[model samples]
Target: MSDITIRHNPDRERFEVLDAGNVIGKAAYKEYDGGASPQRIFYHTVINEEYGGQGLAGKLATVALDETVAAGIAIVPVCPFIKKFLTKHPEYSANTAATTPAHPEFLNEPSPRARA
Candidate 1:
């Protein structure tokens, strides 16, 4: 295993995990910035199946959450992986927020994921 790197790709609104400079996984989010409280709603995460059991997802989640917190933005864990990660990491509770109805409604509509 080579050095695993995680970087925020704001253009994609996702944090990508790279293995030796090749993107192997990403934790995707949708950022809502107009409101008084901005948030990054994480809804998808995926790692190359070949990279399974390597803890890449955990690392990806940790970096994603940490960076989101550092940015002073709330994290709305809409993805099962992220939601579960939050449960075991209560330290992040201060920066976490419940998904509101608007979140669901927005998710239901067309999105970058759908377009992709």
Candidate 2:
């Protein structure tokens, strides 16, 4: 555990958790026109290898999901870690206006593809 700070940079459109001064985890989002309105999509997020398996990624996702809910944005869990996290924690599922596609079929691998 370290002195961590969680912050969302709207300018860069990313949610991050910092340890001391370095970013330990982050979730990135992008906006696009979804027919009649703008949609914020959670694209990707990563926890630094040094901080892996310590639950920092979950913390980052929770904070990001909270912020997205406050802003009234629909969620898209593009990152496998985030998808798995959501599966385990259904509380955050309320933040989403619509559910994302089913969790990627190959999520059991140690490193899952996120760039889809």
Candidate 3:
């Protein structure tokens, strides 16, 4: 919806998509310093149950990722949804900072959507 507003709170490390004054969806992540610059670790993605299956989560993720990427920040998707999204959109893999993390199992297995 054109009226939906996605806002990011850097201090809280969360982003929310509001629809007509109601927060219908939200995605949250923690920023890791990694001894260099901070990299966002996508930890959670949730769309209000009422808003589920409407693609709101995807929209939230897109905006959040775009905003961070525009600011030159890399991302690590620890959330299953986000990992699946990145896997389906290999083009976005370029935005990922680490192909391998201290615990690689944390990453959600990539999807074949983009490859299809």
Candidate 4:
């Protein structure tokens, strides 16, 4: 993990984790207005099989949430990993939002995936 780097790719609407310049995994999400604050609803996360068993996913989650807060955005942890991570890190509680039925519905609407 010496060469690991986490980069945010907004056009693709995800944060990517690269090891030595190759993408090893990603945490994907969709963002929209969440009333109190704009929200990044993380719905899926995966670390390439070969890269599993390490703590890369946690590292990715850390940076992703850090950046989300830096950008003045709130995190909606629909993804299990993200949800679990938040539970362990209560410091982020203030920046997190609980999921609502409409959050999932928004993900299904046509416009969210139009950029892909």
Q: Number of the top candidate by TM-score? A: 4
Pairs that clash in candidate 3: none
Candidate 3 local lDDT, 23-102, one digit each (tens) = 77778876665536557788889988876777888888898999878877788887889988887778778788753564
* Runs of candidate 1 exceeding 4 Å displacement: 111-116
Ranking by lDDT: 4, 1, 3, 2
Q: How many pairs of residues in model 2 come into backbone collision? A: 0
Candidate 1 residue 52 Cα shift, in angstroms, is 0.8
Cα RMSDs, all models: 2.4, 6.8, 9.6, 1.8
Using Cα atoms with residue i matched to residue i, what is each candidate's TM-score against the true structure?
Answer: 0.89, 0.74, 0.77, 0.91
Error of 4 at 92 (Å): 0.7
Question: What's the distance in Å from true for residue 96, model 3?
Answer: 0.5
Candidate 2 residue-wise lDDT, 68-94, digit = tens: 877777666776777788899888776
How far in Å is the alpha carbon of 55 misplaced in model 4? 0.4
TM-score of 3: 0.77
Candidate 1, residues 1-116, lDDT tens digits: the string is: 78788999998889999999999999999887635689988999999999999989999999999999999999998999999989999999999888888886776778766799
**By descending TM-score, how would the candidates be arranged?**
4, 1, 3, 2
Q: At residue 93, what lDDT does model 4 achieve?
A: 97
In model 3, which range of ten residues has the least summed lDDT? 103-112
Worst 10 residues of 1 by lDDT: 104-113
